[model samples]
Target: MRDQEPAPFDAERRLSTREAAELLGVKPETVYAYVSRGQLTSRRVSGGRGSTFDAGEVEALARRNRRDGSGGSGGGNAGGELSVRTRLTLIESDRYFFRGVDAVDLATRHTYEEVAEWLWTGRMVPGITFTAPPGSVSVARRAVEALPEHTAPADLLRVATVAAATADPLRFDLSEDAVLGTARTLIPTLVAALPPRGHDRRDEGPLAHRLWPRLSMRKDPDEASLRALDAALALLVDHDLAASTLAVRVAASARAHPYAAVSAGLGVIEGPLHGAASGLAHRLLQDVLEQGDAAPVIADELRAGRRVPGLGHRLYPGEDPRARALFALLERIPRAESALLAARDIVETTARHAPLHANVDLALAVLTVSCGMAPTAGETIFAVARTAGWIAHALEEYGERPLRMRPSGLYAGPRPPQPLPE
Candidate 1:
């Protein structure tokens, strides 16, 4: 749990507004409001990229809010009972399901776009393809290109989504048909928005083929590698109310459009403990391969007091089903042999101490490393694939009563009549 949160702060420590928001259980805008009210002091980074707040001051303000009886995003109701009803996906034992069918089966047996389309409409359309409009692609690419070169892949996707939304006059239409239309077009737009690597860019094929160029620049993937990537996308399309999916559901509950709902989800996916995990795992695997052993690499990580990435999941004690599904596919890719062995070495080395099993992030790292994709490629794939799931959840939330997800916060502060601070 400590690893899931921002690092602990000292008096002089600085935090980005996003970091401040996570600490205070509020949005970044609320963090700025604290600055405006003189409750916190903020400074602009030297390059004028963004503002940073004093960590100690932010901590003090958080304490004050708790003392004043104001609840925050992390709090639950007094009874502590919280659960949301959903028909999209279910997880029990070690396996998961989508719409009453085995998710692993769907991922292995169908194309990614086919799985995504079925998740939205509850019916399969064989040989289905989603294409982005030229106008949407144009605007989205311009917006993405305007960002700093160091912008994360997920951040690029977020910017493209907002820009694409601006071009759609019917963005607010919550009708099933319209949202479905948004789903089909918006996904391809996201894939197309990213700068392509290979010269063989085409908008006409399986989505995995289109996405391949964005993640890997030099190498055109083999047939087996392409299949593995497709399966990976389908396997990750949705999980039961992941943090990002919950954000999407909440935004949908507020009547935000599908694009906005997905944007909200994209916002949550970049957190260290979430979408970035695969990137970390990818780097870790690179180190292991370079070092010629996982033992020392794992030792150094443990010595640094860092939890090993790509090992163990809170939701699964024995094995992660997604990892199992992906690893099986990776075995068929001959080029993945070395990375696969490294992954096995990692799991076996770590298990001697903590009994941790490999999770999907490790499997994803194997694919990326083998295919010569960047460290961030796994996250980009995750963001692209999960967009389908976010839209499905947004569509689901649009059906129920609005604001149904507003969980009550348990106040832990003094009585309201307390004297004002001097």
Candidate 2:
């Protein structure tokens, strides 16, 4: 696929406070307020003290504030859906790109670590290795072990994140290199700490290999399965600004440490509408495997007044590219044939019955069941893969003005009566 041409950057376009206010439908005071809040950028006039706002920056801010109802604008949407600006990933033409590089290409061609570095820094660094301190891993493992017997994988991951953060003295550094370096070590540490597959070596091979044992119950995973798993992880590395990614950015905007920002992301990831959707989809796919037909199961779901899991996405009108890419990889694996067939049938049925399409969650469900992984395996993949993304977003947020995500509130309750103390 051809890359979309990016608009050229222009810094020469300048606007006076009056011009900016006129464009934004506000007074000069509001424009200056935006500048003071770091929502817009302004520079001093040549050899003069007066400020000149960047017209391009002002316009972009105006558009966002207008949409989100934040920039001296009236109350925002009732749903509070926010419009965020990001350079991490782009979803266009039913496909997503990491910093302009097609994700599908990267998934098949690169490893998770390589794509992660590309997301964090526009350039990929060669021979980059991710390893955490033994002490940190040990602490994280103990924390994981302490969880209840029925604890979910995501819950364990949350506890482990806190434990790892407590052990890392350098986590306080918010610099790009420092935060990214922490991510490098943190990812490996998290993987190493999970319980390994019975037959696989705990300390060998790539990140995907190391993670396979922890997620799947099957023994002796093949090379093809591992490769597909790697692709899935790469594809999930980032996708525009997901809810969890936005949470990470919000935490980072407050100058939180990388670990703190990641913790914030993990909090949102456990929600049913976010990462947990994959687990729910896994259960739905299990029904498909048992019944061997998608039509009945889909019909039953609709009859029961339940929305089918992993069937549609808001961003991709026709089909999710990530789902399409991963499903192709799954079809090639001999052990995954049955599960892949089940997933395909559901996709076809959904398309035929409704205007819905398969999403990455459905693809992940097929992969999990086919590999004999735990029901929560899909969410595990999501959380681990998205750690790379969350940290990358944290890095981006750190470079911006601190606390920039804070939005003004508009009260809606009944007005108070006259003061009683008067």
Q: Which numbered prediction scores highest in lDDT against the true structure?
A: 1
Evaluated with TM-score, which candidate comes out highest? 2
Model 1 Cα displacement at 61 (Å)?
A: 32
Whole-model lDDT for model 2 versus the true structure? 0.83
Model 1, residue pairs in steric clash: none
Q: TM-score for each prediction?
A: 0.81, 0.83
Candidate 1 TM-score versus the reference? 0.81
What lDDT would candidate 1 get against the real structure?
A: 0.88
lDDT of 1 by residue, 1-422 (tens): 35577755586789998988776766577677777877788899998879998888888877766555453333322234334667889888888899989999999999999999889989999989999999999999999999998799889999999999999999999999999999999999999999876776677789999999888875657899999999999999999878999899999989999999999999999986888899999999999999999999999999999999999987888889999999999999998999999999999999887889999999999999999999999999899999999999999889875775664355769979988899
Q: Which lDDT value does model 2 have at 2?
A: 88
Residue-wise C-alpha lDDT for candidate 2, range 182-278, written one tens digit per residue: 9988998888777665766475568898899888877777888998899999999988779999889889989989888888988888887889998
Residue 345 displacement (Å), model 1: 0.5
| Residue 331, candidate 1: alpha-carbon lDDT | 97
